[model samples]
Target: MLTSKTRLLSLDAFRGFTIAAMFLVNNPGDWGSLYPQLEHAAWSGWTFTDCIFPFFLFIVGVSLHLSLHRKVLADHSETQLLLQLLKRALWIFLIGLALNLIPNFDFQSVRIPGVLQRIALCTALAAPLVVYSSWRGQLLVIMALLAIYSFIMLAVQVPDVEGNLVAAALEPGRDAGAYIDRSVFGNHLWKQSRTWDPEGLLSTLPAVCSVLFGVLTGHWLSAKRDIAEKTVWLFIAGLACLAIGQILASWLMPVNKSLWTPSFAVFMTGWALIVFACFYWLLDASPAIHLKNRMIYLMHPFIMYGMNALFLFTLSGLIAKMLGFIHLPQTDGSQPSLHALLYAPIKALPVSAVNASLLFALLFNLTMLIIAWGMWKKRWFVKV
Candidate 1:
């Protein structure tokens, strides 16, 4: 039923590699990164950096397909399954909250609506929808979500505008997310200024569409069909999405992850599909390549994501804070970073930009990997 062909090593390897890349881009030796890939595109576009989150989300859909495809056992009940789903959602949401609580438990000023929280809600929403809804129904829901978000973005106006509020005047689009979130969560949420967060209430609806696309793909893959046929269909579907997304970008919305526009969702979903195809062909069909071994050895995504996720992120935030405040003596005078402390000294020898980042990222990930490997070996997953 579920997890046929031993969990498709390619998928695992791809997942592991992506998670590692997330760490690399996130924690560079310097914020003044020489590599363009290390930085996220400022706004209104996509980049390899942008692909990281969607890739993880898309793979989440793929993993769902592989994990839950089995026919119900004789003793299993839909009621029981539904309970499991709710429990899973609550568990995931709480884990995200736990991550937020780390280092300091600052609820009053703490920002909510984090990455894990989004994944939790998106996954929970998508799974049940996939389970109960027809593909057409799911498609309609996705369209409805995108349409609603667009309307809100374009048509919604900020109330209480006045001459006194200089910041609001400077940026009128402030508090869009906060207005909605405050109405809903009632101040128990992220306060990222007068306007709402880019990863706010509205963006998530379309983000879930990415997961739905994955579920649809998973369902397609799970169908009783020939491998060649499945691969062909997947490729065609990917191409269709890619084409439609590009066409819709101009008329409907721009490809912006910060905004999480519908066009960006479609584009990311399309690329995810294409990536899945390549993995299926090279890794699944040709076992001689031994890609799974690489993933198992060097990656093991769940171990990385589940364990180092909170730990790595916390470490990263602290590193930034330390670098931001702590000044260091420099040849010229003084710099406001510990990054230059290590970086400048290393330059006393010889190092390229990539080499510096690679060395730093490697050390960073190795530290994470060691922690991850400890948990992996112990079979202890810090699930959120």
Candidate 2:
């Protein structure tokens, strides 16, 4: 029912929702003070905030399937299309690297693995398969990726601090993934957590499977099935995934976002599918025509944000960094960063620090909304 040029309103709305959540969670007025739901889980276990990154990656997989399928249908040569995908992936990775070097511009100690870099890597690896492989083949590849990652995590032995190569446990800074990252990138990893990188090379294997799961969902949506039938199947698949992921988590691995564990990938994919299916039903499948129209209108701001997701995401990161970089002198001779200065108004509110932080996040998202509205008005979309 959809075409290359025909915009899927539900997809846009879902993407917009994820982008808004990401901005709100990432740019709290105070990192030291945040609502528990807005912060990531300490090590393991899932939270509302933990869902944003995986949601974005899932959207990426869906977009890739639709876009690449469109290209194939249009008679684009496989060689030409692959080249374009590769170039886009390269640019995304370079942009992520450039963003890391901002403010300090410190090349020697810049973190190599990051959100955008991981997205780029996953896109580069998954795009070829999504474009070329059958649905069953893609499913097999997804299973293979997760299986490989699990084997490495459970079976690989790493030398401990004392230089004894023992089977690595899932401990902070000492996990198999962390050891591999330290070996590969050395000190050029997440400086805050020097011993490990959450988006490290080994962990990216499961992350790739996460995207592949999205590709599978996209292929299903694109199939010539009734809307109700599609929704039912998506629901069924989500439940099965959730059950499988839980079993894996309990027996073999833990569900960890940082590690991109196999169980985590499967669990989050289930969530992604259910959430997207809900959106599709509410926005696209509703029989009430007037109500559907009203719902679409109500979601205009989110649709605007969704349309220019990458641009807004990158711009927001830059703005947040610059705020940290610039500081103003205070009365006591101490300097407060721009972030603190902006937080002054919210800090004065008669609320708990966490509640005040939540207000600040809402205000920040309002600013993004205005910018997105302007872009929407002008039909300005910045594509990568």
Candidate 3:
């Protein structure tokens, strides 16, 4: 088994992979021509794009456990740790809000619910549970949160657009969560659909469960046991979660990403566990030293990307915004966004529209990778 001092290269690599995937999905040249897997599911069910946020949240949980456990072992005061977490979460949330402000900077219609904002909220909320709760307690909290959220989502009556009380439903912007968001956030909701946000407040409860599941996995990894045993059990547990989540999808709420349904939370945790277990086995737990070295070398790029994931995530968003914000004069005297201008040549390439779009995303990822490599070489880690 690895010592506490031994850095988990597998975790870093997994995080890096997730960040890279996020860039790929977020920066497609043509949003209109994306492959199905690159886009989120329309409403219910899920696609590969659905897995990214849950994976990041799971990584956050694991990282939180490992880091906080270290501080506790060193006899750090609880108040100090709590303050640190809050400070970090606050900065992240503000950064997310700033990103939402963008070129327009319109606070009136700015989106309050966002990916990083959700991450920040989840981190802040899960902090106490991670700091004070036992593994069993954390598990119970996850169960309770899921059950309570499921109950509220299914049973709560909400007012519709007409201000009439309506029974609980899961139809697009008509759901209870959406109604709550509309009522609370008002003009501050997601602009595309002002009535609801995928990252709305009520749905955040289950998202915390996603992070706590990772925390539990972190506990398992930190326990004194054979690394191989840990890997095996993690995979087994993941399979169990997967089965249970699938059953819940049919019996309770369908696997919906927008809702952050209980089934989606559990099912994605299963995926996170299974995927991370494979990485752990191959990169950390494997008995074959030569093979492990080769694997590590191959995954070093991801490690670099993961090291400064938050910075890269924020930077990527800003750059993407700028790309669309700046306009270029066109031949007909009309203006096209820099994004459109840059994409025109690529779209004109003798390739399929989807392939061209995919190429642009890959190129954008390459730019990010180069920056990551530079920062890695300089040891310039940007901590939140």
| Top of the candidates by lDDT | 3
TM-score of each: 0.79, 0.97, 0.98
- Candidate 3 wrongly placed segments (more than 4 Å): 1-4, 330-332
Q: What is the model-wide C-alpha lDDT for candidate 3?
A: 0.93
Q: Write the per-residue lDDT of candidate 2 for residues 82-176, one digit (tens) a residue.
A: 88888899999998998999989888899999999999999899878976789899999988888888888789889754566767478777778
Model 2 whole-model lDDT (C-alpha atoms): 0.87
Q: After superposition, how far is residue 369 of candidate 1 from its true place, in Å?
A: 3.0
Please identify model 1 stretches exceeding 4 Å from their true place. Answer: 1-6, 71-75, 160-179, 182-194, 287-349, 352-355, 377-384
The superposed Cα distance between candidate 1 and the true structure at residue 106, in angstroms, equals: 1.8
Candidate 3 structure quality by residue, lDDT tens digits, 1-384: 234476899999999999999999999999899999999999889999999999999999999898887887778988888888989999999999999999899988999989999999999999998888899999999989999998888888888777767766888788889888987999898888788899999999999999999999989999989888999999999999999999999999999999999999999999999999988998999999999999999999899998999999999999999999999887899999999988889999999999999999999999999999999999999997
Worst 10 residues of 3 by lDDT: 1-10
Supply the TM-score for candidate 1: 0.79
lDDT agreement of model 1 with the native = 0.67
Q: Write the per-residue lDDT of candidate 1 for residues 1-384, one digit (tens) a residue.
A: 234335665565556566677777776775664477666777667788888888777877776655555424334465665566667667767766766665467776465677767877888888677566777888798889888877766666644323132222212234344355545554446554434555567678888888788778877777777877887787888899888888778887778787777889999888888877876666555345476455345435544554435455545555545654577776888564676675565545577766776677667667667767776677775543
lDDT scores of the candidates, listed in order: 0.67, 0.87, 0.93
As a TM-score, model 2 comes out at 0.97
Which residue runs does candidate 2 get wrong by more than 4 Å? none
